[model samples]
Target: MINAINLNSKLEIQAEAFIRFYYEETKKSAQQYKERLSEVAAEIRETGTYTHTKQELTFGAKVAWRNSAKCIGRLFWDSLEVFDERSAKTEEEIAAALLRHIEHATNGGRIRPTLTAFAPQKPEGSDIRIWNHQLIRYAGYRTPDGVVGDPASVELTEAIQRLGWTGQGTKYDVLPLVVQIGSRKPKWFPIPGEAVMEVKFEHPDIEELAGLGLQWYAVPILSDMALNVGGVRYTAAPFNGWYMGTEIGARNLADADRYDELPAIADLLDLDRSTNTTLWKDRALLELNSAVIHSFKTNGVSIVDHHTAAEQFMRFMKREQEQGRDVNARWSWLIPPMSPAATPVWHRNDLTEREIDPDYAPQERPY
Candidate 1:
């Protein structure tokens, strides 16, 4: 069909563009670039796709992080460890690779930025898919009282339950890893306890905050994104950077739709919650975020607070400017949920989110 021909042609064009970009960034010889481009052209002509060389894959993976407009951690983009799992086609193989990713990235408790590139989808889109939004996440159980765990996970948790997974029915019960190859049925594997590193919530100044029983999994590995390098789509590529404090505090825990801990936290702290002007939510958020940062540091985990992370993002923009690259960013994402005006990014007027190639795109859930 003409559609197939057009798809192949687009892939060829994207392939050449990425190769040129790669060579430019790496300062490899023009002859080598041309040779690689020619080989890719031939491969696409015959098979409708071309495989990325290990070097190309590595560079491309890093570039994808750099091109991620929503991420604030691009300053450390080059430090990402890429684990190539393109040959992993079975459920056990993929699950094993993901678990290994967890252990390696957890790094005893100091999390490392990592990405595990899985099998790339064909031109028409058939390859591996990870059903979980994150490799290690809390489950949700709906009851007459309410959702007992992460409310964000209610849908996935129900689907996972349908797949015969039973959690321990706790607020912090880590979910299993679910992976699917092609259109085959997905399989769930309980995440090994040894690979999971968790930081229990504790306050540096407020000792009573510990009794709330909040905890978070270390190393937030996003497993549902498709990493697009040139035209090849690694449908199940899971990647992670260490968490920023407000992400867990101001948003994940404090959000009313999420854990909604502010009310209880406010009550515990004895803040006046009778009216919005009392600023009870603001007070609670500050303590929650402080507790998160303090606890993570106490447990030897890598976590960045919003202020430093915002400054670092600006530095990243400056570095890109020095390299004659236009910086693209999303204003909403760059501004931390806790204190927007306190960060440099929130005051910026020119933040625009323009997406580029070799990026990680959010894919629809295969479940």
Candidate 2:
């Protein structure tokens, strides 16, 4: 019923409408997330234990905005199919439109710049003194494979190139960057076509740097090492416990008897059960379930069959519960806390060891 010209016209209109809707929604969502992040930053600042500047708060807000933007962008991409199916545009064209929309949505948003200090002047043969609480050092190298061994190898090099680094003159080139004394050694180097930069700092120093006015590109610190004291921390989930259902076992047995005829549903249920831990909240559980289902369907399994398998698994769980068996059982254990040993030295005074009380229980020591 539709000619090529008419279809093309419809495609253009749909593309425009999608982009407009996406841009507005993403911007609105980003702003909302940013405001919430600012509130958190303000709370941290009020504690006074950690000195956080306005710049640090702003940076945190920007990070929240970026994350929200990314989530919105993904949503837009997923919804593109509705537009694609209704219009006559090719898949590639639809994707391109979505990409452009994302670009427009993210452009000119709040950004934090990389902060570098001037090289501290040290007396000859004396170690350099770093004043700030944190110090970041950027090192350059040339490798054979043109790739760094670290996970950010490709991205680091691309960012460096974007910053206008070209390997023209020297066998080893140094960018206009500064290094701090007593920083940790880097584990990898960038290859010939690539370049690497290492950022080193403690939390206070990072907060200070984020506040400084600079026009450099700084990536949000997302590593676990960046989040914890000495990179050691523990997390707890409260809702972890046994789940019981009466219909579960019978349904499981029935499904097993017709295994080949019904398609292997055990694997699907096992995967779903394995993932439904209290460690993740309700929203995360739903998202993970959706992802698992999508993966199975993509691998040539029918959605209807997947749904049937899920229902059967639920019934099986119910039967197990009726038989006084746990459908799900979750437990938690404490991860050992981290502490550094005090510096050992010669003692001047003779000290006596204290005696333990007879009624006192022996406490277990953590390594």
Candidate 3:
């Protein structure tokens, strides 16, 4: 419950652990660490909470990303570009900053790992929050047949529609950025069309697959999650890294609950989908993953294949090992969705998934 944390004796204990880790990582002097700890304690005694310095905010965010046990992309955790927007109070300011973040992180197709943290939550009052699961996502409309877009976004898409967002009713309609400051009514700001970057899918060899016309956004900036730095809860922090090919191909497009393009893809491939023994789904998934990887590389958008990403994750583990630090990882998540048996991480018998401080965590939905 990092998001719903209250001022209590445990607050100081958690804050101390985070600060101590920060000092050890930064190699700051012992005296400076002690003084800062004292200051933090006094501030908590007086105001029930304390503010993080700019350096603390940035470094703590990177640490949070590094501590995300479920993320296979943690190899690039230290390279996260942190944008501190803690001073934003108005919806306009927050919206403008979000737009700016998209533009900067998009980086003209070479997506960068980036995060922007807004004002932290108070002890009791309105807090800055963004309702969208991701800064960029397609709307889902529940039609008679099924969901027309990303089924994962049905609740949010319906929520926005009720809020007076009249979409074009298209399969890939970009959802508006929903922002809320405290108890005020949430506001929906339509993102400028050009700000969002997408890569259209085109198979390298299967020419007929192009006729399906699939595309996915370049950067996946998760907006609804919270970042806990020490004991301070920055509830409006959004962060993203370039996606692994399997994430889009194996899961988003192939999963039955998501876009469910497997049957369509199998039809294009002329595979024997008559029975599960034919393994048509597996063949279709391979081609789909190949197309996603090929399309992204052809368009110059940064995306890594599952195998390469796994290699990088191993490197990250080795680097942490040299420092005598345990690499907390979730085995199931670290294994690629497409070919779990093909990756080294999948063969491991032990994988620890423990909660670490200064980490990214899910918060109670504001909507």
| lDDT (10s digit) by residue, model 2, range 295-317 | 32333322222234334334543
Can you write out model 3's per-residue Cα lDDT over 86-149, one digit (the tens) per residue? 9988999999999999999999989989999999988876789999999999999999988898
Q: In model 3, which regions exceed 4 Å deviation? A: 1-8
Cα error, residue 60 of model 1, in Å, equals 0.8
Q: Determine which window of 10 residues in candidate 1 has minimal summed lDDT.
A: 1-10
Go through the candidates in order and give the clash count of each.
0, 17, 1
lDDT of 3 at 157: 92
Clashes of 1: 0
- RMSD to the native, candidate 3? 3.5
Candidates 2 and 3 compared: the better one by lDDT is 3
